[model samples]
Target: MISGSIVALVTPMNADGGVDWAALERLLELHIEAGTGAIGAVGTTGESATLSVPEHCEVIKFCVDSVAGRIPIMAGTGANATREAIELTRAAADAGADCCLLVTPYYNRPTQRGLYAHFRAVADAVDVPQILYNVPGRTAVDMDNEVVAELATHRNIVGIKDATGDRERGRDLIARCGDEIAVYSGDDPTAMDLMLAGGKGNISVTANVAPRQMAQLCALATAGDREGASAINELLTPLNSALFLEANPIPVKWAMAQQGLIGEGIRLPLIVLDEQYHADVRAALEAAGV
Candidate 1:
């Protein structure tokens, strides 16, 4: 039952473009202390595509070691190839991650049957909990509700990170698969609404910068505190929206640097936040009192 504000954590990097293990340790400690419900590494926010296989495994292992059972760590082990996904997932299980977040196959655009086979293969191969990630916007292959329902029957396929942001679809999935799957919102903007509609929690990008507030919001929404959640969400809405001024972690990394959480160095192909967007992000931070 992985639920609540599970942060898709950013991998900290130094000016020389190396994985800053010390900074990563500090970030892990900060999240655990701040009451983050779970931690996910090497997801979109962590720049998974750019990282080599060894770096990916190293990051997952580092997160598992750093957390030391303080919190659940869900490592991103998704790939376009089924064999690759299984390999990464097996490595994560070996690294002691509590679970793995498997995003839909990207670029390859596998069919619904292919999607089922893909997830089923990983669940069968790995001896760990698995959460399906259906963010078609990034993967370009939407995992339909029927496919998800089909996968829910697998023992190790425990849950899903639903970034679809479609309340009707989310509600329908909850209605049909309520007893089988735990549905988590992967989109920050509609997280409260999703929770109100019977979602367990959020796998939130916004939580990276505002863990306490995000956790509080999820708690309030899950506990039926709609008024309290709404008030807090109003305060956080700007930060949530601004964090996407560029593709994910670019702006998120920038937000972190503003708070002095990490250095400003982002990897190649994904440059630093453009100077033009600084004022907007800064204002959003101030508005949220970050």
Candidate 2:
């Protein structure tokens, strides 16, 4: 089962608008040291939409190569086009990623039947494990529990990253799907609660900054130690709210640069975290003792 604090990592960039492979290597080392359970490349947190197709494949390949075999690399290979998703998933598998995370088709906003067909097609195309990503906030489309349960029956459709943050829905999914589908929380704020109520773990944004804490929180929560997990989660509440002060990688990339994890360069169309939100993000970092 895919479990524990899986980090939705940010793609590092250089000043001249190129992928900073060296910085990415360092970030991988950091996560490994911090005990991140798994790593995701080219997800929303990794600024996948903005990256060119070649860049996307390169990032996945780089992550897979850099990590070698330390931890499972779950490549974000989702695309609005089924063909594109299949192409990327095949590349990820060939590049050595252990699994693929496929988000529902955005912009196009397919129906539940379309969603099932898209995922099923990708699973059929690739032999590796596939994890469905359902983040309606960004995609503007939600995959209902029934659809997920149906998809879970596929041999390669192994799990899901539930970003909806609806505990009731998540609980219902767990009760219904049980061992068939491994449900992971994609929303960091409610990750502890979800895990306590039987989620597998979190595919987290918070893990970018507080990897050790996030991993520990997931560990504690997964072990059914609600008290311990809650204590650590409180320390991360500020970070959870702050990193999202801007879109995603904007604040997260800024926070990582503050700690010298990456350079201070974000691609165009997406700028640095606004100056106005600096104090709040910094304060949160301090509060979390990062």
Candidate 3:
């Protein structure tokens, strides 16, 4: 199980929207130096929706090559199309990703049965370990724990990133399938509580900016050090909230740019962070000591 703060890495881009390879190398070095447990390349925060298929594969391959087996790489291989997901998963595995993160099919609301079949098909088609991602807020399709439990039984279906933020539901899921599969927290604000409740780790957005701090928090929390973890979480609380001020990556990318980590570049339909929220995010970064 790839544990601790696994950054849902952003694909740094040039001002004209081209992938910035050099900047990406810098960011990878940032996480590696921070002792980040893993990297989620081309995931949501990486703007998976916007990247072309070839581009997506390229990014994953780049990450795998750059990391050089130093840490696990969970490539974002989910797609609304089952075939596409399978292809991406295959590509990630071929590229040497340690695992694949498959989000529930979005926009097309599949029934529980459909969801099961969709995920199962991918898992069956790909031999690599797969982690299910349930973010109803983004997918519009809520995967019930029962569905997750059923999926967990697959030897290749090794984990789930539960972003529901419902602690009770998370606890229930953990009780039902923690022994079968690892459950990771995708919601940053509630991540600590989930980890303390037995979540394996966090697939985090905040880590994009504060990798060292988030890594520390995850280590403390997973070690059952509530006080130590909470102290770090408290410092990061504002950053966790601020990053989502406008859809992900928008605020987070801006924060990283402000820190001179990446340039100001994002794809269409998703613009740069608004000026109104700049102060809020900045204050949050300062408060978090980022």
Measured by TM-score, the strongest candidate is 3
lDDT by residue (tens digit), candidate 2, 75-113: 999999999999999999999999999999999999999
Those runs of model 3 whose alpha carbons end farther than 4 Å from true positions after fitting are none
Question: What do the candidate models score in CA lDDT, each in turn?
Answer: 0.92, 0.92, 0.96
Model 2 residue 175 distance off true place after TM-score fit, in angstroms? 1.1
Question: Which residue pairs clash in candidate 3?
Answer: none
Model 1 Cα RMSD, 1 decimal: 0.8
Clashing pairs in 2: none
lDDT tens readout by residue for model 1, 1-290: 77788999999999977898988999999988888999988999999998899999999999999899989999999999999999999999999999999999999999999999999999999989999999998989998999899899999988899999888888888887868988999999989998988899999899999999998999999888899999999999999999999999899999999899999878999999999999999999889878
Model 3 scores worst on lDDT over the 10 consecutive residues at 1-10
Task: Report the error of model 2 at residue 63, Å.
Answer: 1.2
TM-score computed on alpha carbons, candidate 1: 0.98
TM-scores, one per candidate: 0.98, 0.98, 0.99
Lowest summed lDDT across 10 adjacent residues in model 2 is found at 172-181
